[model samples]
Target: MPSAAARPWRARWRIEASPVQVLAALLVLAFLLAFLVVPVGRVFVVAFTGAEGGFTLVHFGDFFRTSLFIESFWNSLYVAAMSVVVASLIAVPLAVILARHRFPGAALITTLGVLPLVMPPFVGAVAMQLVFGRNGTVNLLLMDWFGFRIPLMEGLNGVIFVQALHYFPFILMNLTASLSNIDVAMEEAGQNLGAKGFTLLRTIVLPLALPGYLAGASLVFVKVFDDLATPLLLNVTNMLAPQAYLRVTSVGLGDPMGYVISVILVVVSVIAMAGAALILRGRDFATQQRGGGGLARRPLSPLGKALAWSFVIPVLLLVLAPHVGILLLSLATVWSFSPLPDGFTLAHYATVLRETPQFLTNTLLYCGLAGAIDVVIGVVIAWLVLRTKLPGRKLLDLMAMSALAVPGLVLGIGILRTYFDVKMPDGASLATSWIMLTIVYAVRRLPYALRAATAALQQVHRSLEEAAENLGAGKTTTLTRIVVPLMAGGLAAAFVTSFATAAVELSATLVLATRDVDAPLSYGIYVFMQSAAGRGPGAALGVIAVLTVAVCTYAAHRIAERERSRRMREGRATA
Candidate 1:
């Protein structure tokens, strides 16, 4: 009934807010439902509901009745709490030194301190056991010097050591940002009021940095609590995550107790992250004025330098010990309860290369596929949130971030629960195929990629897209040419990050892997490490994971550096 002119306008409106956009929005909704919500919902349903479809707390009752389950729940809580405390102690000083002082090798130390993150916690657990174990170097020194060895690598203490070292950088990264960006006038005003030294630091600086500290500490707590591999590797099995994996696998997927554990993990993770966000909601921690030079850097005196290094050197040595130990272990012929290996050989590496080429191949294929899917979805989500006027984009963004809070073991169980009976159009069960592993990898690693894409997109000037459109290009063409090219380096970095991380994902992969032949490098490494003779091969495999992640991490840094240099040159050229 519309006129021709009105029809044209309506057509344009339809194109602008078209079926394509609607389809895309629907796809996002469906994807989140299929991958995240349903699986998690299934877990809750199975956890609290009986097989007869009646609501009951019987599962939880059964779980509490078992002393081991109660022990595991508390053990998880204790480990997480201790990890936060120890990680804070280590991180606070390092962040203070790096952000507020100028010193030799400070830059290098900061970089190396973050390297532990590139290696998976479980992968490094192997090397950490060798270095920090009671019969290890520190103990060896103590035993010879004082005839006493610390229990650094025993029981829950062992989990705390690895997790603290591994996760302190999370706090360090956040605290560094906070300290560097803190308003200089606040400190100057406090100093003018006669406050000085540690008192000033305690009352003024740390209070201002508390938000960042809490943010990082909460993440550390959640991550440590959700982790299964580190505890399983360290032989500390009485934790919620490990128990979830064991009960579901050993007792079969129908176990209600496993689902109860999954729901608890999911709840705790969401609560921890939500609590952080809620605590920051009403506060205005923003600095009114940030100086050009950021925080003031004071140079250490000669004696002060010695004291600083005295604290820092031991930490650096302890942090980098895993890297050294893993490499040495890979080549060691025999190493057991010794300060150093008795002998060395290259046979382990040779063995890995000569046999089990399937794992290497599977890793390459799975990671590559997952990385591509991640980048594609990330770019779409980033564009929708940043560029489009589409509905539910904010919801899409929230869902993406929430994925990080889901423990991999829980996700895996959810996938199994939700899709075990799902059949492909080709009539194959999706739950029993390698495709399931790929899907799990993609979902699990999507957050990192999405964050990268969003950040990269934010850095891009809108005028470039406008200019392309001004030249008669469509939105798609403008995006494909102007935007994608500008974000290529960032997108590549995102892809590498996803790929490298997916390469080492064990928890979800362990559950989703239909068979051993489809298993990736992490499972292979875990299998090898279960036996005494297999330690050498396992170390070698762990080395491969380390190198895989390290190379990708190095490349991402290089790409970022080049992009920064290019931007600087462009700014200078324009100026």
Candidate 2:
């Protein structure tokens, strides 16, 4: 439909890729097709196919007819919805306090708010049981004083409590970013129209941040819905993810119910994502413009500050309870039927270090390899999409990002079902091999690395690469010598992000790790926590996992900050 003049202009923009570029793209596509697409497709195929290999809905019918499956489906929906509500309640006030008000220890509070995220929700579930369960420290004190107790960690309530505490940072981070970017002019305009305080916030501030809130809320819903370890750890199996896990593990992989549940999880995730997109359609929430600033932070009055502290301190304590409980548990020699530990020692840590050093080594090896694979694939995909003229480049990006919708448990099931029979030359099935865990980790964490790589590539001006081309540099040379060096910081950060997250990943690890020696720290923690005697070492392992993730997170931040500062300095120098 373009005119002749426009045709040439468009053609000029589309540069033909070199043979090397073509090959790279093909390799990446093959990897995704084999590992990501085929496995998930196999799950759908199996779910729909009857034992006679004919298309049928019997599996789905069986799923619906079963009372337990029905209860699990509803329980998952209820827990996910309630978790969003509770997480929103916790995150919104804190986001407002941090973004809209100036107060002492605000930075510290903000830092502590994100602490829960570094610890996995499953790990925290046990710690929470110690602190808030019926026989827990708080309940013990309550019964002694008032002769009554609250069922905070009983059944589904425990899952919700642990998940809300662990995952609220998603809402907090997104809403805080949204609130900080809101233009102050809107608030002033609302004040001019006789709106004040909560009225102004209700009318202007909250609506402007709805996009971010919805984004976070949808993420929380999907995560809670897809979570496998948390509910299982809490001894609550009447949930979709846990049921899928249980069926696959206990009932054997041949059962169609697991795949059916996986299909439902995939559907719910897709619907939740699509619903959020639908709600946000055609609505522009962009308030900041050039030279504009965020909402002005007002200094808190003494009474206002006191009220804020009273709210924030308790929330922080409650959120941080898992970390505290885990630490005390790791040190406690005997901590039962009491408010505090009877005694403390370092024997548990010593025992973990002496007995299960393989968990640490396996975590390092698997996560390291996965991170490397992610960065390489991410860079290639970013280049093909942004720089080269490749067909279906956007599709490649979409396929990689689609992993976000695939729950780890679902992915694990798919991987097992798809590859359980495919034996390697070593005479072992590919599904049970440790390499499969690494591959799954790479697939699960690809989206983050791809976004990082794309952002990094975008920041490098094309003129620099063009100059290299002008000087007889080929695409390969230019990328290796110029593009990659510039992107080193971002790529390193991407690797760290991938490594840290993959270290704590348990859903796929649960499905793929068939033996004790091949399992990572996450599975080791799960194994240890199943009995009371192993709780000490499990808590110690949990602490180590938390520390590992925290350090990696800090390193990534520092790398990003240093790179940003360098870029700023370069801009100033050029100017």
Instruction: Give the CA lDDT, 0 to 100, for residue 294 in model 2.
Output: 91
How far is 375's C-alpha from truth in model 1 (Å)? 0.7
- The lDDT of model 1 is 0.87
List TM-scores for all candidates, in order: 0.94, 0.97
Which tens-of-lDDT digit does each residue in 379-421 have in candidate 2?
A: 9999999998777788999999999999999899999998999
Off by more than 4 A, model 2:
1-15, 288-290
Error in Å for residue 351 of model 1: 0.7
Candidate 1, run of 10 with poorest lDDT: 12-21
Backbone clash pairs for candidate 2 read: none
In model 1, state the lDDT of residue 482. 89
List ranges where model 1 is wrong by over 4 Å. Answer: 1-16, 423-429
- Best-fitting candidate, measured by lDDT? 2
